[model samples]
Target chain A: MTVILNQSFTGVSIGAVLLLIALGLTLTFGQMGVINMAHGEFIMAGAYTTYVLQKPIGDAGVSLLLALPVAFLVAGSMGALLEWLLIRRLYTRPLDTLLVTWGVSLMLQQLARDIFGAPNVQTTAPGLLTGSVSVAGVNLATSRLFILGFALLCVAGLAAILRTTPLGRRIRAVVQNRDLAEVSGIATGRVDRTTFFIGSGLAGMAGVALTLIGPIGPTTGTNYIVDAFLVVVVGGIGRLRGAVITAFVLGLLQSVLEYSTTVSVAKVVVLVGIVAFLQWRPQGLYTVRTRSLV
Target chain B: MTTTSTPPTAAPATEPPAGPPETPFLGRFLGRFRTPAAFLLGAVLLVGVAPLVLSDFRLGLLAKYLCYGIVAVGVSLAWGRGGLLVLGQGVFFGLGGYAMAMHLKLADAAATGETLPDFMLLYGTEGGLPWWWQPFANPAFALAMTVVLPMAVAALLGALVFRRRVKGAYFAILSQALAAALAIWLVGQQATTGGTNGLTGFQGFFGYDLNDPINQRMVYVVIAVALLLLMAAARQLFVSRYGELLIAVRDSEERVRFLGYNPANVKLVAYVVAAGMAGLAGALFVPAVGIISPALIGIVPSIGFVIGAAVGGRASLVGAVLGAIAVAWAQSTLSDAWPAGWTYLQGLLFVVAVGFLPGGLASLRTVLRRRRTSSDRVGATKGVTT
Candidate 1:
């Protein structure tokens, strides 16, 4: 019973990290209809931001706190720039977006390698977050608990903003119908840029959280990319609530499966499961009814 | 059947599947001649002229490139003509390659009178050859399996995917995931598949010495001939009514469905054909390149196949072949010069191609011609007015 509880905790923590990453992916894909393959790089940028700040600040906790916002700003600006330069022209061509963004992804990965060096960089966990808490024979690490909280906080904040803000309203309007939104006096382009910024910023925040779990590297983003994409896809395109639910389900499932089989086999099983799931629910967990929208 | 055998000057008996009806008999004749003429010329250069000019070593490199060209041609058909954007040719390529490689290993074992291949002895729990590797002992069976395996896999996969009406990004992601899954699976099964440092140490291919210079040259000749033959087959598909149907499916699948034609079947045929070609390419690649591994059959390499066709212009057969060879040649040359820089260049080229040069190198001529014609018109008008 303790082992199962511990496993479930582990699953929840893993699910938190996936939720953070998939949130950004869900927003970008849902709103813009653009598959940004460079998204993983944005996450990498955030993690690297944390790495860079750790040295100068000389306090792990303080640096981590500073790194989150800095990472968001840096990744967000880069996302907006890419959106303005390359993505704007390819809105009608989703497949072309895949190819172009893939190119962008490769370039960004090389850039990371050049800047950070090829070797993985380790970041120390904050002093307060290093220890574990035991309850009923289950030892839970503080860092995992913090990550789980952080993920919830971010999701809540995003939900609140979307629910209450005029910007969120504009974003929703544009997403529903760009032409209609334009006629109603909203600048769809600004909304697109803003959404991309927020989405990439969230990816950056996920990166900072990622460092709490493991070492940071140029290829770190790639490690989570396929899983994150699957999360967004399975959750349903353009549905934040669905993204949250799917992420936890996938993450927990993988965590449990890893205990029984080799990691590679577990991954294969998960992938096959997802493929089967897709066969059953092609539109995913949530589908928006639209007229003649292919 | 005789129509296909007729002289280049002969008017085609079969009506061209596409193009305007006003296209004259002479235009149709030229259209028919164009592909075969190009094929003959390319065949002559590859089979006849190349051996004379290139050294044995260079010819060997060209043979490896021709294998890439073979895959690229299929990519062009599936992506360019069919608009399927298949990002997992590596799955089929690996299928073909492993089939041939297993056969070679089995045949080597039989000749030596050994119970199992060397890898099995080195890595397996039991010393005997696995049951799956048993049929590959026959050279004929191995060859057939190379072609049949990919086709069957593609047919099954295509039926599932297309029947579900899963197109666009979902299809691309699923296909890429398959490549990734296959690679991981292959890497995990070291005992059976020779994981990581994949299947090598072959002495001969059907009694031809791999190390002998003459036999190496013969291998190149065979591949060059195969390339020409495959291109001919692709060209036949391109001009056929089926090709028109594929284009229709690409443009608007729903409209095709409404017209009472099954878009899924059309897509399935192109997908299967592409997979078969990729498989054959892999079979040839194993002998020429002397190795096959998970690294060659992963998501990255699958994308690599599409990149070659994209660079050459996916719609043009010659372009696909040329693009594949050019990209392969460029990678070798660039890597020799700067080991770490080629990927950056490749990425940049991919971005530029997708963004600005959507039609690839094949479209450059038309762009230039349009500019020249406009300039000439301006010149002629200025002179008349003056």
Candidate 2:
């Protein structure tokens, strides 16, 4: 029973991480038709950013806090530059965008390897969240629980901004109908740039969040990107709620299966199962509005 | 075909002043040598003579290129003609390669009289071969499964995704994510799937000594024949009615649907065929290369397949085969020359190809023809005074 509880806790923590990583991809894919295959590289950038900032801040707590915005800025700027220099030209040609972004991803991965070497960098969790908590005879890692809460807070914050802010309104408008929104005096080009920045920034934040739980490495992002993409797809295009639900469900399924079977088999089974499921519901768990005003 | 005459406005250029000079037989034949049939003949000659001209090592390398060409043809069918952008061909390729590799590994183990592979013993796997892996001990079963399994998976995937109308980048991303997941899963399953080390150290293929020059040459011949057959098959499909509909779906899915045809079915058929071709290529790759690892079937390699197809002229069947072979050859030569710099050179090639030659080398003739005609017209206009 205790083992079950522990597994569930771990599953939730993993789900939280998956949610964070996938959020950016969801936004980018939803707003701009570009798949942004380099989104994983952005996560790597954030991880590296966190790793670099760790020494300057000294205190673990302060360093973690400082790494958050810095990662956002660094990754966001890089994403913006990629959009300006390469991605913008490939619009409407999604496959071309995918191939180009893949090239960019390779370049970023090689750059990271060159700069940081191939070794995994160590990171420390804050003392406040590092220890375990005993709850109902189940000892759960405090850091993981904090991460789950932090992820929820981030999601909620983003949701609120999307619902309440004028900029959010503009983004939603463009997502719904780019031509119509453009004709309505919305500068869609500006919105596209800003959306890409915010999406990439979120990926960076996810990276910082990841270091609190485990080690950072050049290829660490590759580990999570697949799961993130699965979550985004299962959640449905352009739907935040779908991503969250799918992430949690997949996370729980994977954890439970890992407990019952080997991790590798569990993963293969889950992937096969998801592929089958997507065949049934290719639009994903939810279908966004499809009324093309243009 | 339409029998409409050329427009009067376009006729002025074709009309000669009094009588146009007839081209000599030699000139006409020389010009005819540039035709598609001539190109096909030249290509066959070049490939056939390469083995005799190049060293044994280079022949083996070319054989590897042929294997990639087989897979590239499949990629072109699905991505170039069908517009599926399947970014997960690696998963199918890996499946086929691993299937063949497992059989070879088992055969080697049996010959050595070992209960388990050396790596398995080192990893402390005391148990006998896993139940699922037992079927692969039979060489014939392994080969059959290698071809069937990937096709089955692809068919299932196509039926599901296409039925739900998941086209464009969504489908591409989904497939790529699947490839990435499969690679990681293979890497993580150390005991059963051989983990990151993958399946290697095969000594023979069905009682034939793989290291013998005769066997090596036989492998090369098999690869060449298979590639030629696959390309011929792809060309036939391109000219068929089904092929026309496939391209139609790609250009306008809704329009195709309105024309009393199921676009999804058309795309699905092409997708399955492509997957089957990829699987066959992969099965052949194992015997030719004598190794199959997770590294080869990962996201990067899958993208490499797409890059080759794109660079070769995805729409042109011959271009698909030639482009894949050329890219593989370049990669081998570049890696041999400068291991570290090959990746940068590859990137530059992709950038230049995408920017300047969207139609790839296959369209080079068309571009040249356009230029030649333009220049000839310019000369004709200037010669009016003469």
The C-alpha local distance difference test score for the whole of candidate 1 amounts to 0.83
- The two-chain DockQ for each candidate, comma-separated, is 0.36, 0.22
Instruction: State the C-alpha lDDT per candidate.
Output: 0.83, 0.79
- Tens digit per residue, CA lDDT, model 2, A82-179: 88887776564556666777777777876788788878998777898888989988888887887788789878988887889998899888777777
The pairs that clash in candidate 2 are A279-B160
Model 2 Cα displacement at B352 (Å)?
4.8
**Residue-wise C-alpha lDDT for candidate 1, range A61-144, written one tens digit per residue:** 999999999999999998999999998867656676778888888888888888889899999889889899998999999999
Query: In terms of TM-score, how similar is model 1 to the real structure?
Result: 0.92
Show the lowest summed lDDT stretch of 10 residues, model 1 chain B: B1-10
The predictions' CA RMSDs to the true structure, in order, are 6.8, 7.0
TM-scores of the candidates are: 0.92, 0.88
Clashing pairs in 1: none
